[model samples]
Target: MAALIVAAGRGLRAGGDLPKQYRALAGRPVLAQALTPFLADAAIDHVMVVIGPGDNARYAHAVADLPTGKLLSPAQGGATRQDSVRLGLQALAATGFDGIVLVHDAARPFVTAALMRRTVDALQSEIAAIPALPVTDTIKRLGSDGRVAETPPRDTLVSVQTPQGFHFKALLAAHEAAVAAGLSGFTDDAALMEWAGHPVKTFPGDPANVKLTHPQDFDRSQGAPLHVRVATGYDVHAFGDGDHVWLGGTRIAHDRGVVAHSDGDVALHALTDALLGALTEGDIGTHFPPSDPQWKDAASAQFLAFAAERVRQRGGRIDFLDLTIVCEAPKIGPHREAIRAAIAAAAAIRIDQVAIKATTSERMGFTGRGEGLAALATATIRLPEPE
Candidate 1:
């Protein structure tokens, strides 16, 4: 299955200088938070986003540090939300996608894995399915004359939310038909399905999946101060017969290489472990085993990226990554800033958030003897305090 995230709206009502999806929620962009679960989900095969024109820069910055291997090129959006959905569906169809597609709202970033599972599972027996919460308040309908007109029973009412799941071809055809018929007032895709004579099933919705709209929704106090976690990681690689070495995503000229299953980037390996430690996830070996033949020559930058995505998956952000490289050769003085930039790009944080230092072991340790290189890294992160 695939997902199409609708983030094309101006969202000025959210009171941010940028679009609400590009604005910060917790410590990362709202759209990043919204995209994390879907990207991390095993059931989803592809994810695409619809963006407004002139939002290219904002969109790039929003998902800059995320693991987006499955993300397709963003589709340009039209004027209204309905038009954006139709265009997004059309774009997906152009890719020859005919499987189920989940249409989600960018404003609702709290979408959970379980909620997505429920939505997807409901589609097995229905042409269309949506998540909805039962209404509990009294209903009212007033006359245009400013008088009480009628009150309907609240039992029949429900508030709907995305991601609304549907057969891609079915929904695309319905949208085309609606456009041909000059239908313009439908509030959601579900309503359009109703107009096209498709029966839409309802699944239970999550109340915590509220949309962030008002300015106060981004207030730190409303969500409480995040939990601060500090963790350390260390890695060492012995010199072997090679002409180059990889460190922090950079390939440098060297007389020898490190013995390892992967590219043997000690800096990124240590940083990846430090971030996993901060998230209390296992070390690099746990996620990527040395015994795995597929990772025999993989780049370490992707390892760092995977670890960083785990933090985002848990609703946290990396604050700082401080690394100290211990070596007697390769002279770290010149590449300090380059190493920092590479680490920052892999970990999805600003360069200022990364710190790199170098030292020699006073000509006593193995590092001082020039047999190998070692890296020590400490990762600091902020996560929503567990309730």
Candidate 2:
């Protein structure tokens, strides 16, 4: 099978300097996200991306790092998405792949690998297969007076999405037929295939696989393809008489101790806050209240670890952590790498993703007076969509 990703649309509906497909969602381009599943599939022989003439330089820059073996950029596109698709199909047909053609929209970033596979399977028996989600809302036809003219049966209604699959040869013939018939108003490839007398089967579609048609749509779906967030934190503990102090899960003897009910590991506290902030959950206090006796003198690192694991179990991934320690005494430079490693191990992420920095208070405040130590941390996590 091969793929033709229609990205040449002017996106006038989306309205932006860059076409909707080239815009950034999360940290990657929308088209990139949309193409990932197909690129990963061994069955997809190649992928042709059709772009507008003026977008050539930008398209190259946008997809410069994508795999070249199965990806291609054909000549500049015509005025409509259907024209762009036809151009892409001609390029694919030239490549001699007549197995199946999967036509996808570059604006639908949330199309999952599973959905693509399902569509491919359906194409094995039918001339064409389109992902169509069952509509859950009431159906109505409005009159010129803004009244309901006819109520269609909701049971038979379905909202179609892509990557709509078709036999490569059949799809090409269908498009050519449509062109010959002077029909250019197809909202999707399946409809065109149906018009050409090819049976198109329906496969399950993801509700979250939404196309970005307007500015608000992009805003709603932009971000890591996963539904995750990043947050940061910082805290300080003053020095006072105490038996021992905790630092990144290690006990250390100190002249003065941080004043807190817990071990007063300011670094861990800040990081905890950051993690909770990312989850949009309440702060550490809400989870482990100071009012609770069982938490008194409890390890703050433990609390942070629990929060990290909670997000992990929720199908989320922490991408990075940046921790900074500030104090004049109990020098932090020696423990930087060790602390970073420890944090990474606890957060279940790579060492490179975790950073630890140290700075002196410059003798300017309570920390400068050597009364306490302070630490701040930032956490970046990738949260997958809820099942």
Q: Name the top TM-score candidate.
A: 1
Q: What is the lDDT of residue 95 in candidate 2?
A: 69
User: For each candidate, what TM-score against the reference?
Assistant: 0.64, 0.60
Strongest candidate by lDDT = 1
**Where does candidate 2 stray beyond 4 Å?**
144-146, 223-381, 384-387
lDDT of 1 by residue, 132-185 (tens): 999988878899997889888898899999999999889999999999999877
* TM-score, candidate number 2: 0.60
Runs of candidate 1 with Cα error greater than 4 angstroms are 220-222, 229-387
Q: Put down candidate 2 lDDT per residue, 168-196, tens digits, no spaces.
A: 88888888989998999888888888888
Task: Show the colliding residue pairs in model 1.
Answer: none
